[model samples]
Target: MQSDPHHDSANSVELPTPTAWPIITAFGLTLLFLGLVTTLFVSLAGFLLGLIGAIGWFGDVFPHPKHEPFPIRPHDEWPKDVCRVGRTVTHLHVGEHGHREQFPAAVHPYTAGFIGGLAGGAVMAVIACAWGYLVDQSLWYPVNLLAAAGLPELSTASTEVLKQFSLAGLVVALITHVTTSVLVGLLYTVLLPMLPAKREWIWGGILIPLMWTGLIWASLRFINPTLNARFEWLPFVISQIAFGMVCGFYVFRSTKVSTQQGWTVAARLGVEAQHPGEKKP
Candidate 1:
């Protein structure tokens, strides 16, 4: 028999094994989309299954009394120099005595993203006003178009008459535009935390905005005939792209996670920053 120098049964950790909850949740979402194309029964079934799967997944993600608290790997056990979660970067550093410490880049992203969206919307509104002034000779022309969604009569208002500000139109337009901006900002906060830090633009800027624009253009007539009739491709494209960039700005740079607690979160998320034995980091 070999003598052991280091052995501690009490401090030994207990981790959860691999789970199929994610697969189940994915299957549920797939059915939900399929239900959109098929029947209500199918959709309902999908929704129920997805809800169950999601609950299970969440349960698995959060710590349970059965599982031991997560333990950090020692300095010599680290696999990489850096690992990123959301926008937080965990730098694995070794000290003089070979003690390891994780330095995380901390930030608050949701508020920043919302603020960025508001700023971006203001910029877009200004640009729209400029376009209206130069081309239509009416500062109120752009706002009136948004107002026309609810007040159909504004669609046919003469340029001369529309040049003067319509209080109703301004109110409607501001409400419509600001609401859309806030919704998109909220979406950014949700999605940024779920995506890889390096591919922020791919999902946040290019893909999501492009997909949203296409959907909007395709459904414009059905969504709002008055606005559809007056849609201009140039300004629409510019504004969408600008909005995405501005939204991506805050989401990419401002999200943060504490390295210690974040390690467990990253592990649960199946991010590349997980510990060596469980998965590749």
Candidate 2:
């Protein structure tokens, strides 16, 4: 004698009826786009399928949405282990020290990151320029390589052309270099704090640069064929290390501002006082 699943259930929920119209409509849309590269007949078939699906979907919802009643079994029918409730939640007061373990309790300000980035970028630029001068006897060579990723004209340029200075390449390189430097600097502020303070330099300056350098080496051909064809790995790795060290050190030295994790909503929003003795900002 098997008992009915919903025998003890008194309440039921009316959930939306499952239908195949949506699948048909999606298939039609896929075919419609596929037809652009195939034939008009495929497109016509897709349109017909889409129209029929849309009409059927609309019919299911227009006058009154179609729904199916789902009976919920009583709690007694549930497995004993699943039915057991966990311990009650305890709420912590805001700004209460040592209440919970919060990571990155503070962080360096954006201004610090910005300044660090500029400093790092300057150092990186100097190293890159020095590499170009030493290797190719042309200061413009490295800058041209950096810009070659974005500028189509430079992609196929000869080694002699790459050594020659171009105004367009200089502008592109400057923009790309500054933007990347600043973003990475800001990232350091967030990431370095999460690492062990005693060995942050090892992770940020050495390990991180090596890891990303390897990644870039692997993907450079796809990202920039022109640069990949003429990439000097040792110089690139050195520059990356210099940038990371400079940026990480600057950010680590900067004063850290407390996070808003311990602040109440009102305090965070500056709408009301956080504590009884505190004044609203």
Candidate 3:
């Protein structure tokens, strides 16, 4: 009663649908553009942090299995189940020719991490920009600057004196970088999955605006009006559309590429795998 490796488990005779590429290409192009647009503001650190998250997510997926593909026995007699959790696959059966991806399942960890972090960073960049505007006003900046900056913190300087020094401005900048980095990294690791998959069309589209708007709104509602005045509250979510679109394109294309290349989507639910260390195939 085992199924053919070439066929899908659902129908026993059907090939799993190949992924659609148009969506992916569009998404990737969109991201590249968004990355360009965001070069205007935000620290580079946020993108770097987001990249780490992405790399980690992609690297451990579908490790290389060592066992050869099954069916040293007849196709019908091949062992249907080979993969288990925490197992490492080093080989795979590719159309009767034993082939391999030539890399560990952890391939491109840094690249994935970098890109994921970039996205995470981009989002946080927005939040930071929005929130920074709120934080930059009046006494708050001076207080935080004195505490966070080196010279100001070490010196018994008056608030007026501290405001004139380089340390205060530097501290604010450092705080900005740290806040974006952490926020973006957290966004990638924690928030990304909570939303629907990136290409869910209706949900994905609406979520972009909804999220940015909420962040912007939250910034305004909580903060003093004086600070909010400095913030450039451009169509709030208009920029986020580019971000969302970019993420969408990656999800669509990367997913398709994985399928076309005989890989499974890491984000998919309960999908089984066939690793290389099997005794039968």
Candidate 4:
């Protein structure tokens, strides 16, 4: 007797059964970490939940994986296609210009990013200094605060000490500020092109600043307790916005270069042989 093909196909189409063990394990892990911030009781509860979940999850697969048989519908019960057919599909060659469907076919050069970063950093410094002078009556206060991230001495220094100028603080602040600005500027070059063209400015200038500010606000306590203690949210936010706006505008105005994504590795490395008839200019 011949076996029924449909029956065999249906029997072979077994899928893994849905289980709550994974979610339970995830919740357990979350609580376990959250306990670091809260209390040991939560961690104990999480450990119990995690152990139970792990045991149950392993039981599903130890000897044999658990699966459920999926019901197969007859061909006659399948939905009919209503869309038009036989439309010609256009094929793209790998080396062809603008053949990629992904956004950002081009990007600003590294030079542009570097210059933009410097410009933005200058603007940000100006704003920060102004805030320092206006609010703390000292031009060195903000600089000292920034340097405190690296200088442990400054971290514990008195408010009066922060207000006084220190050559070491100035050097540290300048280096930190420049390095961070340039890195963020390079990131902007990569990010801005992926955003909607019309809304790039809004995202780069306002939204991005606010987002990083929130992140810094949350993490600052652990990263630098001193800066977190004396940190003024308003001034810091303003300086960040100023940096973003200046950097974004500069990069936006700079000329973009085609990405070499479509080029062959040899061509990108300038090792591809030129065509016989091609003239070197």
Off by over 4 Å in 4: 1-105, 264-281
lDDT of 1: 0.71
- Candidate 4 structure quality by residue, lDDT tens digits, 1-281: 03223333543556677999999988898888888889988998898889888998999877867776677787787799688897966745433443442334457887778888899999999999998999889999999999998898899899999899999999999999999999999988888887876778898899999999999999998877878999898889999999999999988888887565545567667898632222211
Candidate 1: which pairs clash?
none
Alpha-carbon RMSD to native, per candidate: 18.3, 9.9, 27.3, 13.9
Put down candidate 2 lDDT per residue, 121-214, tens digits, no spaces: 8899999999999988999999999999999888889999999999999999999999999998888888877777678888878888789899
TM-score order, best first, reads 2, 4, 1, 3
Better of 1 and 4 by TM-score: 4
**lDDT (10s digit) by residue, model 1, range 122-218:** 8778878888888778888888877877776676676555677999889989999998887788778666656766777777777777888899999
Looking at model 3, report the run of 10 residues with the lowest lDDT sum: 252-261
| lDDT agreement with native, every candidate | 0.71, 0.82, 0.43, 0.82
Q: Which of candidates 3 and 4 reaches a greater TM-score?
A: 4
lDDT of 1 at 10: 50
Error of 2 at 273 (Å): 6.6
lDDT of 4: 0.82
